[model samples]
Target chain A: MAQSRNADGNGVPPVGGPGAVSLALTVNDITRTVRAEPRLTLAEALRGPLGLTGTKIACDRGACSACTVWLDGVPVCSCMILAIEVGQRRVTTIEGLAEGERLHPVQAAFVAHDAVQCGFCTPGMVMSCAALLAHTKQPSADAVTAAISGHLCRCGTYPHVIAATVAAGAETKGDGP
Target chain B: MNRFALAHARTIADAAARATTTVADAMTAARSNATRPASLIKAGGIDVLDLMKENLLAPDMLVSLRDVAGLDTITEAPDGGLRIGAMVTLGALAAHDMVRRRYPALAAALAGAASPQIRHVATLGGNLLQRPRCWYFRAAAFHCLRKGGGHCFAISGESQYHAIFDNRPCAIVHPSSAASVLVALDAAIELVDADDTIRRLPLASFFVAPGRDTERENDLRPREILTAILLPPPAAGLCTAYLRQGERSAFDWPLAEVAVALVRNEESLCVHAVIVLGAAAPVPYRAQAAEAALLGRRVDDNAARAAARAAMEGATPLPRNGYKLPLFEALVHRAIMAAVAETL
Candidate 1:
């Protein structure tokens, strides 16, 4: 039973009890450790200790796709998964999708297509589209629609989102910059 | 949400032991009318986290079963059936090639359920064991009969989403679309008790009606873990189909859903039939009368309509939910017709 100190220098309790424990996560290809309670969700841990505010948490429940994140290359609701249960899986947030100053194909296409309005659901929508493109190089319109079906764009950018994802999928296939 | 201890179980034995100890504590606490559960098992945490966030459930301890080995594989059983681990996510189940080829109804049900994000994380066992999505039971403000309260709020208020059959003292419909298809396929669930003893229960018998027990929805006892689900080998010339009519085309619970599995003879005459309706009753409502109507008869359009009429024979709908009767009848007709058409 190992214990870690919190940021405030408080003595954290050992793991497997009703106290905070140190959890190591591989986020954006970097191994970051944070001490948090067992009940904390992956979304909360990422936003709080990891400071990855790119993943939004509009609905704390699993209904909203605002907290979507890639867990082991699959898009899952981070708000529904426990931080402690993430164990050794790779986590990719919206902030990790871009390389340096350049944007991922999905993000660039989103901007080009003007798919974002309020921008609250952009991160999640981008992550989902990126995951779809990571698997399918040339996704059809229906495929892109099905991929982002869980996400709710209150700004009603659905048509543009579909166009951007389809265009990004084709761009990825063509190896375009 | 309330603060509670968390226990990570690395083995199924360890999880059962922890659950057994906690169930005893929970039983003792129940004597004092404690609202909090003594312990809960978290597989995927989709439903558990929602209940916790809504303050509907407070557990003293959470026994996490994610680290348990051999709980996430889908394999072929010795009898040519499929053995799906309890922890296999809904997305994986729907996308599995074997499931798509052999159990298309189950795949369709899974694909239509919840959303892409939820299906990626929600496991089969958790989906089957999850609580009802009734507004009254989900909200902390409404102490419905399922929550150990004296009265059922849905009976008198907002009965549109409530059950239309077998809803006595409680009106919440069973929310698992997968379970309805599984029941039609005659699936069996494997359970591991705290003593390491294994038990198998037919999927149809797993859900308990409100008349039998108001506090719980299923037959799962304390200190028991649903380890796997076993699907029997497909019968000869068997054809299955699932159809759900939701309010929305995507990411919405079914207003009325039906799954039909029928085995036809070489001449295209029905030999056996099973029709299970979901979100229409407190349990997966088996249309036995409808099945009888299709026995030994050619499953033509006229016969399908007749069976559908028989399926709605004894449905006691609430004042607000009578619309479900016609809706369910239409689904039943479509499901049977589609299943019969598949045989051709």
Candidate 2:
């Protein structure tokens, strides 16, 4: 929070912008400093500056969920938030959803059920579905439906995604999200 | 999106002072080119970023309200009502226990809004003030009336998803469905200006008809910041419901929406009623004639049918958007029936 040109006593002044600024961002449990423009979106920063292409950017707008990421454990469109505005909120992308050398339950189920086609919306879809399982132990089909309602799957794998999410929820051994 | 300086404010007064200054600069710039906002206030950045990306309004500075204290909470109001911070996200409002149990209609409206990701980041204040999703207005290539052009392209061009009522030169419908429910609930909004002067107004008055102003959507003054939404105390016999018809069940903007608030006695006679239509007009269309048909009468299938017919009165739909009439009629009837069925 202290890394700002606008750290005046009254309040923060206008920081960053129009020019490239060195900004620190915590991604996948590691804080990486990147130099980028203020107008650059978090999705762009993650994929470009941070070199994490796992978080795809299809629409580059909020219309698509291809850029979905966890901002403090809640699913939000990465394209909707400015990279500079992410501040201290820890961003968890598709890359951080798995354990060491092991895919998350939702990711494993996606593979098992063949829920990937073009795989453009896969990362975002997986991020939202995984967030749902973190809280719901046994999410029903409707719960999965509601969780991924914002996601657009051109592959028409709605049934497969729902099945994979429900199976992942049921397969979880303990309270882990 | 243009590269702009991000200004953070810690207090309401600080935000307002910076906001007023920003607006003054923005208006001055608007006088010449009117291509962008000089300095803009951003809540969730959902709509603001959309505008910036589409080249509608670029800002030299964005006064971020994300750091403002006490603006991201939901607490009980002194009048025994719910005081929702302007920054409260739709996701939090929908998942809130009290909002779901006591104000089911509001929760339902919130649930039907946008997608999960949008509901998580889009704030209440930002939703109320979001720009119309009209294609012409959004496309930078075409300069429409809202964009300081002479004519509204939707009036002569594609208007399949446009408004059916109260749309004059600008045919685009209001984008928010929650604004309808809030008006039905008789909510109020608190606004604080740069002078630290806070004032409240009925939520109904907050929306601005296109006839009144072609560009501005709501009564939000650039110099003022909406701090909170004050919901009235729950009435014992009140029943409320919100329903919408859209292209898709989820993730699509509503084609037509209806929100109803009815206060009926134990015998099921209506004592008071409010029916506000969303995505059907330039603002939340208050169907006063529809409400009149239900006053002092037993709310039944016959009453619902009569009110539905009355609600569609005075509609002047443009070409290719007449389908909204039947959609609004059906939604109003279903919403009325749905509101009454809550107690059952």
CA RMSD of all predictions: 3.9, 2.4
Worst 10 residues of 1 chain B by lDDT: B22-31
Clashing pairs in 1: none
True interface contacts retained by model 1: 0.60
DockQ, candidate 1, comes to 0.45
Report, for every candidate in turn, its global Cα lDDT versus the true structure.
Answer: 0.85, 0.85
**Alpha carbon deviation, residue B303, candidate 1 (Å):** 0.1
* Highest-TM-score candidate: 2
- Candidate 1 docking classification: acceptable
Please give the distance, in angstroms, between residue A47's alpha carbon in candidate 1 and its true position after superposition. 1.0
Question: What lDDT score goes with residue B305 in model 1?
Answer: 95
TM-score (0 to 1) of chain B for each candidate: 0.95, 0.95
Q: Can you write out model 1's per-residue Cα lDDT over B14-95, one digit (the tens) per residue?
A: 6776663322123222332465347667788888778888876667678877878899999999999999999999999999
Task: Pick the DockQ winner.
Answer: 2
Off by over 4 Å in 1: A1-15, A174-177, B21-37
